[model samples]
Target: MRQTIRNVSPMSNEGRNAYVIEHLTDALLTLLRDHSINDVSISELCECAGVGRASFYRNFESKEDIVRLYINHLFCEWADAYEQGDDKPLSALIQSIFAHFERHRDFYGLLNERRLIYLLKDVIIGICGPKPEQSKDDAYAKAFVAYTLYGWVEVWFQRGMKESSEEMAGLFKMQGL
Candidate 1:
């Protein structure tokens, strides 16, 4: 049976790529679940994965590398969802992202706050792109949407995912972007 992403298209070759990434993700999650990101070592990761440092490096530069790639790959998936007729804007994407995070909660729960912040910003900018407000240095208006999405999404996660996806979709829709 073909796999689906939130009742969307069946899985593809991209699924194989995601499978590899998920393994790397799983290894990292095991480390974080054991302790925290700070306590984990590259050597330990290699040992746990039973893959050489070279094998790890072949797939990723560092643990964080895989995390970023994972996020980017999800974005590509989100973008593809649009191609598949799910054009609901940032909120739908955010809901899917929440599901993604929930799936890898251990890894992120232990991530360096700075790295998480950067990752969030990277994703926000990737989704929002260069706005006219930013181009014109509109300050609050320029950054409002991204920052709001960034802050509140973190808040949503930290608050134990109290909000439903529809609630989040409402939040994004309220932004009127």
Candidate 2:
């Protein structure tokens, strides 16, 4: 849903805060897709989000701040699902993540670049907590997960999202992440 951060009572600070967070998320996705992460500017972002500069600064120091918040929301949901103690929880967790990438296909496409994907993986790992094993075996697991989902989303989009989400999830699970 589109978000608006204006017209709410200033006294209801909590609601206003939520409004700003959601608003910035929508704007950031559009701006990043159009101008990319490296080119997007704070003024342009605030303009797209329809929030004032001061309000933007109040909520996010920069575009990355807003982007990080949105990623964390997805991470928290995935973590919660994985933490539910299902067999092969990591697979279940990967399923939750595939759904997320499916939603943000445009941004996921941008992450096809290896550098961007690794950067994203680091951010996600940092936010999601409980890092993977610090062994040679597990070193690439987190990065691989991020890259796989991003690439999968690109393929799904190009293929017109032909499979149902669960079907795609199952396909991803079979990949043995």
Candidate 3:
């Protein structure tokens, strides 16, 4: 399945904030598949997203902001699903994630190629609302879980996402992490 950001015409009916975020995120992903993020300029991104320079600036401070926001958007969707009672066995969350990644495979592939997946580890963990114990050990444990899950997903995408979601979940179960 091909997943794309909604175009401007349909996005006009969506909120302005959502419109800007979707367009800018999609435009960045589209460009990243062919060009390095450093090689992309605000003008180029604005043009690709079909928004004026002022509009882009009004929404985002820099190109990096777009990447961060895009990652946050994905995590937020997962959080929403969990809130809506999708959470059961952890495998269910893993399955939903695999499905989500499949939908945005191209963008995830570009992020993987650019070595930017690490930047999202904290964001993903934060959105999941892991228990907030303030102990040093607790912090380390959270970091370990975040990095392990994020790293696994990054490697999976880097490897072309060949495994089925159930297969991936089974591998995790075998590890007992």
C-alpha lDDT score of every prediction, in listed order: 0.63, 0.65, 0.75
Q: Write the per-residue lDDT of candidate 3 for residues 47-165, one digit (tens) a residue.
A: 89877777678888888888988777787886686668844776666667777777777777778788777766767577432566667777776667666777788789778899987
Model 3 vs. true fold: TM: 0.74
Which of the numbered candidates is closest to the native, going by highest TM-score?
3
Q: How close is every model to the real structure, measured as TM-score?
A: 0.65, 0.59, 0.74
Q: Which ten residues in a row have the lowest lDDT in candidate 2?
A: 110-119
From the highest TM-score down, the ranking of the candidates is 3, 1, 2
**Candidate 3 Cα outliers beyond 4 Å, as residue runs:** 1-18, 128-140
Supply the global lDDT for candidate 2: 0.65
Question: lDDT-based ranking, best first?
Answer: 3, 2, 1
**lDDT tens per residue, model 1, 48-117:** 7544566566667677787677677766875675557645555666676666566656544555333453
Clashing pairs in 1: none
Candidate that would win on lDDT: 3
User: In model 1, how many backbone clashes occur?
Assistant: 0
Better model by lDDT: candidate 1 vs candidate 3: 3
Give lDDT: candidate 3, residue 41. 90
